[model samples]
Target: MELINNLGLGFTTVLTFQNLTYSFFGVLLGTLIGVLPGLGPLVAIAVLLPFTFALDPVSSMIMLAGIFYGAQYGGSTTAILINLPGEASSIVTTLDGHEMAKQGHAGKALATAAIASFFAGCVATVIIGLFAPPLAKLAFQFGPAEYFSLMVCGLIVSVVLASGSLVKAFGMMVLGLLLGIIGTDSQTGLQRFTFGIPELADGLSVAAIAMGLFGLGEIIRNLESVKSGSMQVSKVTSLMPTRQDLKDIFQPMVRGTMLGSFLGVLPGGGALLASFAAYALEKKISATPEQFGKGAIAGVAAPEAANNAGAQTSFIPMLTLGIPSNPVMALMISALVIQGIEPGPAVISEHPELFWGIIASMWVGNLMLLVLNLPLVGLWVKLVSIPYKFLFPIVIIFACIGVYSMGNSAVAVATMAGFGVFGYILKKLECEAAPMILGFILGPMMEGHMQRALLIARGDVFTFFREPISAALLILAAVALGLVLLPSFQKTRSTALVDED
Candidate 1:
């Protein structure tokens, strides 16, 4: 009954003219971003973060959330129609999706992806509404020690799950922690690493860093490898799937949704991991595993469902615990902070409208995506043919404009440029920027919590162990780190991350 009333309030908020319009535009732009290669939700959200300041918190969140999940819908379009993956999570879709296109079942593959995504998105939204409140309630029990320990656990989990060298990920995380402390000391009223720069007093702009690393850095890399050619788009004859197709995909979609929903709640697990894991599961279980790369419809259905489900449920931790599951959630946390709302357990109690409105908008947005993806299939395919040379300059200009708009600071622009080069270098070294971003976002909060806990305990370092919850969290962190260091686990991790390409 409480859930019903809350959902009623949510629909009322989302059904407003302004909020609906923003949601539509957000999903539309997200699909466009997904249809185009070399761009992702992180870059799009970062580029638009500054502009969202003008909107109300609820409206801004509604739109941004739309973009995140809507990308899942659009990514499959490129994966099916062409061999390219528009988003990292869509990479698995290309294996069977493109094969279906080659066999002249392009329309069937596209339909399967859309239907599976819509179903998973709808189910995941309900799951969020059902589970988030209890999680938030549970978070209310956390003390400073527990909070700090939880962050330690989260960071360790991110390191364990990160693709590539654990040492490199740890190094990047430490670097981010160092960068995060570059401003003034909150307690001492003195500077730490300002180096006499006035702008450093307020700390580095998250927008500037995010835009530079993801937007500008990606553009520069894409430009270097830009090919001059038009892509061949598969022609869509029928958008409708056969009755048998629906029956065949229903179980895979359900299984994928279940798997993704569980994984999405874990630290460092999101759509990319969920999609790959889902495809692997389906292939392993199938009686005719040989047909997996030969246009099996289950391949299109499962991963599409998993990715979309993972994308939506990834909000659980961010909204409830203030811990980000991925870089995109880190940005969402920044958005909440910018809106003067501290993200965590208090979000639901203090701002019910914002919480429920965003949840309701996910369902509405998925319906819109289902409506949009089918008819506009041709439009998306046509968008793929646009040359990268033309798009790269535009992306760079927008990134610069967005960063500069924050307080009109040239120092911020310069900061972005520096990070762009730094990001490119990290990419060249096969390092991921996600862990660094997470550390940067969490470092200050973790430091603050630890300080408060120590002060309360009369400077006793063992206070963390005295608290059962904190002790458990720290133990979990140690176990996670220990498991990742094992030779057998390392081999398994590498094998699981191997891409079809």
Candidate 2:
């Protein structure tokens, strides 16, 4: 009864004219962004974060959430039509999806992707409604020690799950932690790494760093790799799936959704991991695995469902426990901080309207995406044909403007430029930036919690182990780190990550 009431209130909040309009605008822009290659939701959100200051928190959140999942819907369009994945999660879709396009079943493949995504999204929303409250309730029992241990577990899990060299990931995370502490010390008000720069007083801007690392960095990288020739887009003869196509896809979609929902709740597990895992599962279970990369409808359906489901369910940790499951969730936490709302157990009780409104808006946005994606398939196909040369400049311009607007200072823009160059160098070195961003976001909070916990325990070093919850989290972190060091697990990790190459 309470759940129903909360959902009702959420709908009431989201149904407002301003909220609905922004919701539409968000999904629309997200679809457009996804249709364009080399621009993901991270870049889009980072570039737009400064502009959200004018809107109310609820409207801003709704818009941002829409952009996050809406990209999933649009990404498959390009993957099927032009053999290019608009989002990283859609990379698996390019396998069988492009194969289907070449086989002249592009419309069928697109229809399967759209239908699976919609169904998975709706189910994931319900899962969030049911599971998030209990998780948030559990979070209320945690103290500073438990929070600190949980962060340790999260960082370890991120390291274990990151698709790169373990040493590089760990190094990046440590660097991020170092960067996170650059601002004035809260206790003594002494500058740590400012070097007498006035702009460093507030620490590095999250917007600047995010835009530089993801937006401009990606733009620069894409420029180097841009092909000179035009792409040949597949034609959509029809948009409806046959009855057999539906039958072939139903079971894979269900399995993918279930697997994706569970994985999505884990730290560092999001759409990219979910989609890859789902595709592998489907291939493993199929009687004729050879059909996987050769235009199998199941191949198209499973990964599409998983990525969309994972995208939505990844919000659970972020919303309930204030733990980010991925870099995008890190950005969402930044948004919450900007809104003066702390993300944790109290978010539901203190701001039920904002919490539920974001959830309700997702359902509304999914429906909007379903309507928008199918009829506009041709439009999206045309969008994929746009050259990177034309698209990147606009993104660079917006990213600079957004960073500049944050402080109206050239230093912020310069900071972004420096990070952009740094980001490109990191990319060239094969170091993943996601874990670094996650560490930067979590480091300060982890430090604060650890300090508070020790203060409460009177400098007792074993307080973390003395608390049962904290002990369990630390043990989990230790076990995950241990597993990563094992040779067998290293081989498995290499196999899983090789798909990205």
Candidate 3:
């Protein structure tokens, strides 16, 4: 009864004439961005955030969140129609989705992706409705000690799951932490890391960093190996899946949704991890493993479901625990902060409308995606034909204009340009920027919690271990750290053996 009432409240809020309009535009624009290669939701949301300042918080968030998941849907179109993946989460989809397109099943593959995504999105919304209350109840259980410990564990999980060398991941995380501290000291009111720059006092702009690294950096990279012309798209037949296609995908979709929902709720394991993990699990469990990647419908079905489910459920930690699981969630939290609404457990009680409205908007957004993807399949294919020469300038202009709009400051442009160059360097080094951004996002919160916990403990070093919940979390972190290091140890030993031989 309570759940139904919450849903009612959400719909009442979302069904407002203003919100419905923005929500539709959000998904429509998200789909357009997702069909383009190298343009992810992270860039899309960051680029468009400035325009939403005039609207109410709920409406703005509704639109941005739509873009986030809408990208997940649009990315599938590119993956199916062309061999290239528009988003990293859709890379696995291209392995089989593109193959299915080659086998003259392009329409069927696209239809399957849309349907599976819708099913997963609906299931994920239910999971949110059921699990969020219980999880938010945790606010009462966590003191500074517990919160600090949890953040530590979250950071470790980030390093463990990040792609590339362990040393490099840790290095990036440390760099992010350093960058996070570049602003004025919150407690002491002292200016640190300003280096005599006045803008540094307010700290680095999130908009600047996000646009520089993801938006401008992407355009720069895409320009280097520029394509002379647009590539051909596969011919899409009837956009209806047959009886066999549905039968094959039903079980896989369920499994993917379940897996994605669980991972997406974790502080560090988000949609990227969920999608990859789901694909790996499906390939491992399929009856005919040999057919797994050779145009298997299940391949397209599972990962698409997983990525969409993961994208929806990734909101869980951000809403309930006040911890962002990924950069996209971090941006959402920033949006809430800008509205003077602190993210965390009390959000449900204090701002029930915002909480439930966002949740309900997800389902509406998913429905919109289903309607958009099927009939507009032809449109997305045409978009794929848009030349990079044309798209790159628009993206570059958007990045510059969006970053400059923040506080009407020119410093944001300089900051974005620096980070754009830095992002390119990281790409050259094969080091990921995701973990670095995660560290940047979580650093201040973790530091604040640690400071408070230590103050409460009167400088006792063992206070973290003395608290039961904190102790268990620290233990878990230690074990995870050990596991992360074990592979490196084994590799080093093997190398030594080879040298001796």
Candidate 4:
């Protein structure tokens, strides 16, 4: 009954004219970014973060959440039409989505992606509404020791989630932790890694690292492939799916939504993990497993559905606990704080309108995406024909402008250039950048919580194990790390490795 009342209030807040307009605009902008091959929602949000300062807390959150989930809709369009996924979460869609396109069912594949994504988004949002409050109540019990142990576990699982070379991932994580140590120490009021540079005193900008690592890195990588000849874009047919197509996809979509919603709330694995897990699960359970790699409708539907569910549910940690289960959610948390709205268990009680409004906006945004995506498929398909020479230059210019606008600093531009070079080399050396980005986001929080925990524990490390939540998190992290090291896990791991090569 209370949930019902809260949802009614949420609807009232979201139904306001101003919030509705922002939600629409967010979905529109998100679609544009998702359709553009080199760009993703992370870059889009980072680039636009500074501009959102004028918005009220609820409105700003609504807009950002719209873009986050809306991108899931547009991501599959490119994945199906061009065999290129704009976001990491969309990569699994390319496996069967592109294959379906090759079979002259591009429209049907796209339709499934859209409908499944919408359903998953709505269901996941409801789950969040129900679970977030209770979860946040539990989080209120966490002392600094619990928070510290949880962060350690998150970092370890993040490293294990890396697609290749555990050593390199660990190395990158340590480097990120070291970089996180820069600026003045909160406890002793002394500078640690500033090296006497004025900019270093304030600490490295999140905008700088994110834009460089994701935006610039993508540009450089694509530039290297510019001369390697053009890609094969699948031809578009009818824009609507047949009745048989709908029947075939409905069950997988439901399964995916359930699985993704469940997995997304977990600390370490979010959309990226959910999408992959959904794909594997679908293949295992399917009566026609042999059809999975060969244009299976279930193959396309399941992961597409899962990715959006996971994307939506990831907000659970961010909104309720003031912790981000994923890097993208971390970015969202940064945006929330920039608006002076501190997210935690109390956020729901203190700002019911904001919490529920964001939830309501998600459902509204998903509907908007479904209506927007199908009609625009032809326009996006045409984009696939753009020449690499023209595209690569524009990508470089966008990266530079995005980095510049985010911080208003020339040093940030320089930092981007350095990261660009480093990222390129990392790619060349067969190291994955995904885990590095995750590590960079998690490292600071990990350190802050650890120091706080030590202070509260009087330097006794045993306190974490005394708490059930922290203990469970530590054990899960251990199991994940152990699985990565085991010989059997490596075989499955190798096959699922993102063939960035």
Candidate 5:
């Protein structure tokens, strides 16, 4: 009953003209970015982040969430048509999706991907409605020690989730924590790393750093790769799937949806992880596993559904506990902070409209993708052919104008430029930025809670273990780190090297 009422509030809030319009535009842009061969939602969202400053918190979050999930839907288009996975989560789809295209079942493959994604999205949204409130209530019970322990667990969990070397991921996280402490100390009012600049008093601008790293750094990286953007598509017979095709896909979709929803709430488990896990599970369970790499319908349907479901449920942690489950979630939290709203368990009770509105917008965005992506397939493919030379310059110009617009200061823009170079260097070093960004966002909060917890315990560090919740979280962190140190785990990491970034 409470869930229905909250959703009723959500639908009412999102049905407004302004909110609906922005949501539509956000998904549209997301689809466009997803269709491009090398472009992903992370880069696109980073570019669009600066523009969201003009929007209300509810609308900005709704739009950014739309972009992230919308990219998951759009990525399947290229994977089926041109053998390219625009988003990392879509990588599994290319295994059989492209084969389906080659076999002249392009329309069927695309339709299955779309319909499964929609179904999974509906399921995932309902899961959020049912589960988020209880989790938020649980989070409300956490004390300073518990919060600090959870933060430690979050950081540790990121290293596990990261695709690259665990050592490199941890190094990046430490760098992020250090960067997070650069501003004036909130409690002491003393400067830490301002280097005699008044603008540094508020710390580095989130917009500048995000735009520089994701927006500018991505452009530089893509330019180095330099590939022709033209796409080749198989002939489309019809968008409708046959009864047999639908039957073959239904169970896989259901399985993937359930699996993804469960994994998405876990720290560091997200769309990419869900997609890969679902694909592996489907292959393992299939009677004729040999058909998976061929044009099997289940191969196309399961991962698509899992990734979409994962994308929706990944919001659970960010919205409920104020801890980000992924870099994209971290970015969403940044949006809330810019709006003068501190995101945490209190958000559910204090700002019900903003909370529920974003949730309701998820279903709306999925419906829009189903309607827009089908007929617009040809249009998206054509748009992808536009040269990178034209795109990156516009992106650079947008970054400059947007960063400068943050405070109307040349200093802010320069900070972005510095981070752009730094981000490029990190990319060259094969270090993932996701952990770093997550660490940066969580670092300050962790320090505050840790200090408060210590002060309250009268400098007795054993107090963390005395608190059950904190003790469990810290134990989990220790176990995770311990597992990473094992020789077997190191060998597994070496053999299964995946790149989320």
Candidate 6:
């Protein structure tokens, strides 16, 4: 009954003319970004952050969130049509999606991705409406000890969640946390890592680091790869999935939704991890495992569903706890802060309309994606043909503009350029930037909470393990760290290494 009332209220808030217009535009632009190579949602949202200053917070967030989720639908279009996964989450789709395209079933592949995304998005949004308030209430019970322990858990999880060497991920995360301390101290009136750069006093702009590491980083990598050849594009067909296709996808969709919805609530698990994990899990359990790399419909369905579900559910942590699980959500939290909205447990009670309205807008946005993706996929395909020469400059331009617009400072531009160079070096060394970005996003929160917990405990470090929740968090962190070091797990990884002939 409570869920139904919230949905009704959500609909009322989303039905407004202003929100509808922005939602539509958001999905459209998001699709455009996803179809283009080397531009992910992180860069998309970062590049667009400056423009949101002129809009209302709810409207801005609604649009940004739409773009974040909508990119999932758009990304698979390229993964199937061009064999280029527009976003990291869509990489799994390429195994089967592109093969299906080659067999003249491109339309079915795209249609399946779109429909499953819509279905999963709907389920996730409804779940959010039902669970968010209770979750918010639970969050209200967290004291500094709980929050600090949670931060420890998040930081430790970063090592396990990272793709490469655990040591590297931990090193990068520690570096990020140290970098986060560059500005004026929150608890004291002192400067730490400024090195006398006047702009450092204001701290590094999230926009600068994000745009540089993700946006300019992509440009640098693509520039190095400057390929001299092109491949044959697949011919698109009917956009409808057959009955058999639906039957094959039904179970995976359900499983993906359940898994992603739960994991999405975690502090560090975002759509990218959810999508990759779902793909891996589905492959492990399928009766026809060999069909996975050869255009299995479930391969297209499961991860696509998981990514979309995770994308939507990721809003829970940001809204209810003022903690962002990913860079994209971090941008949303920043937007809310800029609007003078302190996002926390009390947000639900204080700004019920904004809270419920954003929830409502998600459902509406899913509908908008369905309408937009079904008939307009061909247009998205056309974008794939856009020359790299014409495309990259625009991305670079938008990136520069967005960074500069933050406080109208030239320092931000220089910061972006410097980090772009740094990101390029990391790319050259084959170091993954996703973990770095994740570290950047989580670093400050983890630090503040750690100190708060220590302060509240009056120098007693053991208090974190005294509270049940905090102890549970600590135990989970310990187990995660242990598993990552286990010899058996390490052996399985080595056995899977590709052997060159």
Q: What is the lDDT of every predicted structure here?
A: 0.90, 0.90, 0.86, 0.81, 0.86, 0.81
Candidate 4 C-alpha lDDT tens digits along 143-175: 776777777777787778766778888887788
- In model 2, which runs have C-alpha deviations exceeding 4 angstroms? none
- Model 1, range 153-264, lDDT digits (tens) per residue? 9888888877777889889888878888988777678888888989888788877888778877887788788777777778777889999999999999999998888778
Per-residue CA lDDT of model 6 for 101-208, tens digit only, reads 888999899888988899899999988887889989998899887876776787677566656556677777777777777787777758888999888886888888
Collision count of model 6: 0
**How far in Å is the alpha carbon of 499 misplaced in model 2?**
3.6
**Cα lDDT tens digits for candidate 5, 1-501:** 888899999999899999999889889988887877556777667667768888888898888888988998888998888887878789999999999999999999999999999999999999998899999999989999999999999999888878787889999889889988988786777899899998888788767777777767777788898787455777778999999999999999999999889878776778888888888888889998999879999998999999999989999989999998877787788778878888789999999999999899998999999999999988877766688888778777877887787677788889888888888888899888878887888888898898889999999999899999999999999999999989999887776664222
Model 5 residue 200 CA deviation (Å) reads: 2.1
lDDT of 4 at 21: 98
Backbone clashes, each candidate: 0, 0, 0, 0, 0, 0
- Superposed by TM-score, candidate 6 places the C-alpha of residue 142 at a distance from the truth, in angstroms, of 0.9
Per-prediction TM-score: 0.98, 0.98, 0.96, 0.93, 0.95, 0.95
List where candidate 6 sits over 4 angstroms from the true fold: 228-231, 493-501
By TM-score, the better pick of 1 and 6 is 1
- The clash tally of candidate 1 reads 0
Residue 200's lDDT within candidate 5 is 84
- How many pairs in model 5 have backbone atoms within 3 A of each other, for residues 3 or more apart or on separate chains, i.e. clashes? 0
Report how far residue 180 has shifted in candidate 3, in Å. 0.6
Please state the error at residue 167 of candidate 1 in Å.
1.8
Q: Which stretches of candidate 1 lie over 4 Å from their true place?
A: 499-501
Q: Worst 10-residue stretch by lDDT in candidate 4?
A: 492-501
Number of the candidate with higher TM-score, 4 or 6: 6
Evaluated against the true structure, the overall lDDT of model 1 is 0.90
